[model samples]
Target: MCVSVCVSHGICRSLSLCVYIYSNTHSGGGLRWQMAEFTHLVVVKFKEEVVVEDIIKGLEELVSQVDIVKSFVWGKDIESMEMLRQGFTHAFMMTFGSKDDFTAFQTHPNHMQFSATFSAAIEKIVLLDFPVVAFKTPQ
Candidate 1:
């Protein structure tokens, strides 16, 4: 049997060795545990004339509509070395509580609706999904 504990976002672990550590504060002012968070990462190169602000707005709307989304962030590339960028100018990352949660987000109606518009604006895109692991620092 496996067991785990949660204490104000402090370290928690299962007997099977699934471990979690605190990383950031939640909106309610308590530290949020690392948990088994799964991340959805996307890098994109937009077609010319695509307004970036619209993309950001649509993505933000999805996070609001999807309860399973734990956190969301996006940004434009600002790398000084253009050679390394490979023409991908923007990136988005979303964190879900678990792999199951991530899957739910994928099929969620809000996601489906948003993806249609989002995909059309992209000239090129790459997506990666993974469980967060191996943080460099511990709290």
Candidate 2:
């Protein structure tokens, strides 16, 4: 099972100890070994005036220019009952075969350029990198 806890800055020291215990028991080598690959969930909150079409256009242009992006899916937020409450207006789910592939994407010039272009349109952003643990169904 995967779990995450977001903590405020002041409580980080105390929360980190709890995070460490949970991570050590739940996310060690044995857990990591079960994954097929990992994915980076790039969640972005756009400015009020930014439309979904504009975001899609920007992402299409961005992905076309980047080589390190193995595969990606970009979309607007959907209604959900989950606690996260779809805070981000847009989401880009990108998959990489390995950590090296992801690292290359992070440092690639194309990505940097894209970020420069896209950052001005965003109000807030959050990125969560999660490992693929136990895919019971075939991809």
Candidate 3:
């Protein structure tokens, strides 16, 4: 059996939230995700007087240099609804192919340096990770 995976713009197009991947043909052509992915979700509230722009830029640059980072996104809170008071003003979502990849990204020198600075400037944060068991998207 052989598989043809889709890679778009260096991103595994098949590896987004709730999306499915197909590979390894049986008697009929089909696809499957060879491995599950890990998601690292982080929310942070900057301390007073901290330069939020610099922090975001540093984090973006740090993750870009880590080869294990399959996908990464960061942004400020949208503040759409009235009950959206989580206090964490920024969010980051990063996906990795495996725990090893996640660890590699975490331990990368650039990440280490960023963490050192981020830890000091953030007043509060919430970090959570979980394996993506299933993902779905609407048309």
Candidate 4:
């Protein structure tokens, strides 16, 4: 977890916030996502009646159709002792090269369309845009 992203962006406005780092390597092979200078993290908590699977599929489709997103990945929470999570269960982290790129993504018609449905299902959300400072990789 990388705290700097959340802190620098004032996401959750705390240093102790849990930060999830994006993986460079692809799950199927060694191919890596194009390295970007910035990363945007989005965590969402859906309402009780919201179907989690539907939300995941919508995100996958939205990202697949959006070129502005340099890379995208998501997963569900397993189990954690940390209590700050506040019942948030799903997270999506996407990487983009520039603020302009991210802005474009935010305003994209496709994204806007997707958000209508996504937003209605979400109960709460925490978003963080992280600027890469320094990272270590396997040697």
Worst 10 residues of 3 by lDDT: 1-10
Show pairs that collide, candidate 3. 18-135, 18-136, 22-31, 22-32, 23-31, 23-32
RMSD of each: 8.3, 12.3, 6.6, 12.4
lDDT string for model 3 (1-139, tens) is 3434444312346534332344555745543444356889998888989998888888788777887888889888776452674577888999898777787877788888888999999998999987654322223
- lDDT for model 4 comes to 0.71
Please give the clash total of every predicted structure, in order.
Answer: 0, 0, 6, 0
Query: Considering every candidate listed, which one attains the maximal lDDT?
Result: 1
Distance from true position, residue 38, model 2, in Å? 2.6
* Tens digit of per-residue lDDT, candidate 4, span 1-139: 2222343333322343224354445445432222234688989889999888988898889889987676788988888555977888888998776677887888899998998998899898999986644333333
lDDT of each: 0.77, 0.63, 0.72, 0.71
The weakest ten consecutive residues by lDDT in model 4 span 9-18
TM-score top scorer: 1
C-alpha RMSD in Å of predicted model 4 compared with the true structure? 12.4
Q: Once superposed on the true structure, which residue ranges of model 2 sit more than 4 Å away at CA?
A: 1-33, 81-86
Candidate 1 TM-score, true structure as reference: 0.76
Ranking by TM-score: 1, 3, 4, 2
Off by over 4 Å in 4: 1-36
